[model samples]
Target: MGAWSKVRRVFTRDANIVTAEDLLSLAREDRLGGRTVHVTNDSALRHSAVWAALRLRADLVSMMPIDVYRQVQGLQVEVPKPPVLISPGGSEVGIKEWMYSTQFDLDRAGNCFGIITERTGVIGPDGRGLPGRIDLVELGEVTVRAKGPQISKYKICGVDYDPWDVWHERQYTVAGFPLGLSPVAYAAWSIEESLNAQQFARDWFGAGIVPSGTLKNTSKTIDRKNAREAKESFRAAVSNGDVFVHGADWEYKPIQAVAQQAQFVEARQFGMGDIARFFGVPGDLIDAAVSGSSVTYANISQRNLQFLIMHLGPAVGRREDAFSRKLLSNPRYVKLNTDALLRMDPQTRAATIAAQINSRTLTPSEARALEDRPPFTEDQYAEFDRLFGSRSVPTPPPTAPTGATS
Candidate 1:
């Protein structure tokens, strides 16, 4: 009992620590239409357009394989089986799944976290505890607590984790905020509006495809129950454009309403574009209307380049920086290989490779490798040297004037 008390005292007592407060309590909540917009992965995914945009972005980042390399002198070369590259979080799931899940959280909530598990004592000089498993923690379940001297601690899954034990990648933040603000949270109002529109559509369509109208029975008095019964009977019988025969006394009149009053189609289309804009995704990319035209891009390559530059570039950059800082030692870095994403027409690709080789930016062998061909053999290498080894550049023979050429 005495020894246990002594150990407890050692952990509890601190020289400068005085108070602690949870950051969530201090956070300024953002609300819309008298309701707080709670942006969780589930809630954000409710809107099909928003979900499509997020899925596109998440898959774009996660599908790109991560390559780790060591920089020696001026050249960087690939390294195999780096600690972080191995099964993330000590789980059987490979890095691909880990990255996909993390990116989904990051895109949905504007933040992602991983709890590092150090299994051994061979820590690095900077105290990056030996390459350990990284377990992903849901952003919704994490809370920040402030200690004195500007230090922050994390409460994850109802358990306290020292800040050092967790890696948090946040999208944005401001002064006086202990937690990083997520893009989804920032655009919560737009997402909620889009969700509401989708829900309205489903509910409206589920009841009946036709618009609401009034039914009349001139011959017999129609009671409330009878009216309801007649409406149900009419819906069940002729909902799908089936023919209906009624007595001369029965009359059906569709409500005369302009689309301006309903505005269902316009509202839905607008919501798709608004939500897509918030996510930095092209509306047309997610099957949304593009200027009332089906044409979104001239070709697939142009669309891909636009997506990479506008949407995926910043995302990829953020992950690269975070991984480099948290998972690698000095002179070692992580790279997301996006070569596969930059596809082009065969003629264009060949022309681009030729230009690179001619400019000396890329070697002939390297271009061949890009095309999935093996390196040059000894004989090929000798032939290449024999042709281009001299200082003089190769030139084509001059042609005579158009009509005189023979």
Candidate 2:
């Protein structure tokens, strides 16, 4: 087992890549009042000083040295900073009374890191695209890491979303396996949590808690029951768009693939069961058993995700996170000769699969659905119609009826 297999409960995976420039753009798109990192560094905004600032509260301001002030654009947007007071002598109300002194200076990235690192933190992918721990730099010499978060900052599929309030905001939505999971308790009451429990008993069916034959039969029985439960989950998430039903093709392929190979899901289940037992929280709500550093209350979360992936299938790219319009065309997963391999390698397979694809045909409805989406332009549409008649597949246009008619 890898470290991930040890506790097997908590972990982060990077699917979101927001660069410094990207952050600046996002800030601009929001029409921020702060123009530069410097002006934004005011104590009130806390951009230059705090360990973390919510997107709603903070704005990225670019900073300029006295010499480079002219080169920086967008100076008009800088928000006004609050006044900083001077604290001096024993006569001062307090020795370090000026809260401004503790805040950050936007001109200094080092100081900015110091403040944010001390507050909330950022996690991202290492060069390898795996989840690396979150850390902030201090004075360009020291490193400060996120102790633990008070929210859900991890990227899923490919989006970074922190949409909840209260439990997911102040502290990590699920944290401190030993601390009793600050707000993980609320998840226990969620519909998703109960589904995890149902899936759990099914995964354990063949563990041989009973006679061999009985265990096999019991496992099958459990699987059958779980299937209906799983479908209920699928329908709920789909209708709600938590998991989408892509037309008919790509929608549930990932889910089916995951179900077929839910071996990873099973091991993960046992891991969470152990964690729940350790913490005395309900197993359905908390899964603390991590392969290594994965412990905490994310266990149930992981299981719920497994169930989703088991039904929806994994995806790639930004919009890929939400079930796309692709799935409705091929709901089940299949290989090159089959169906439901998400986003086939358009480049490499274009030639080889062309022959295989051309051999098959589609019905009127299927053919129409295959039409390339518009803004393909009227000219492009006419060209295709001229060539392939009505089919979207790449076959040469039908030979116009000899010399018969116009």
List per-prediction Cα lDDT, in the order shown.
0.68, 0.27
The TM-score, computed over Cα atoms with residue i paired to residue i, of candidate 2 is 0.15
Residue-level lDDT tens digits of model 1 in 246-320: 889999887644364367566667878887887878888898864656655776788899889988888788789
Q: In terms of TM-score, how similar is model 1 to the real structure?
A: 0.69
Q: After superposition, how far is residue 15 of candidate 2 from its true place, in Å?
A: 42
Question: Per-residue error at 206 for model 2, in Å?
Answer: 46
Candidate 2 lDDT over 272-312, as tens digits, reads 45434322233333333344454243343354344334321
User: The CA-based lDDT of model 2 is what?
Assistant: 0.27
Which residue runs does candidate 1 get wrong by more than 4 Å?
Answer: 1-40, 119-131, 147-151, 208-261, 292-299, 376-406
In candidate 2, which residue ranges exceed 4 Å CA deviation?
1-374, 391-406
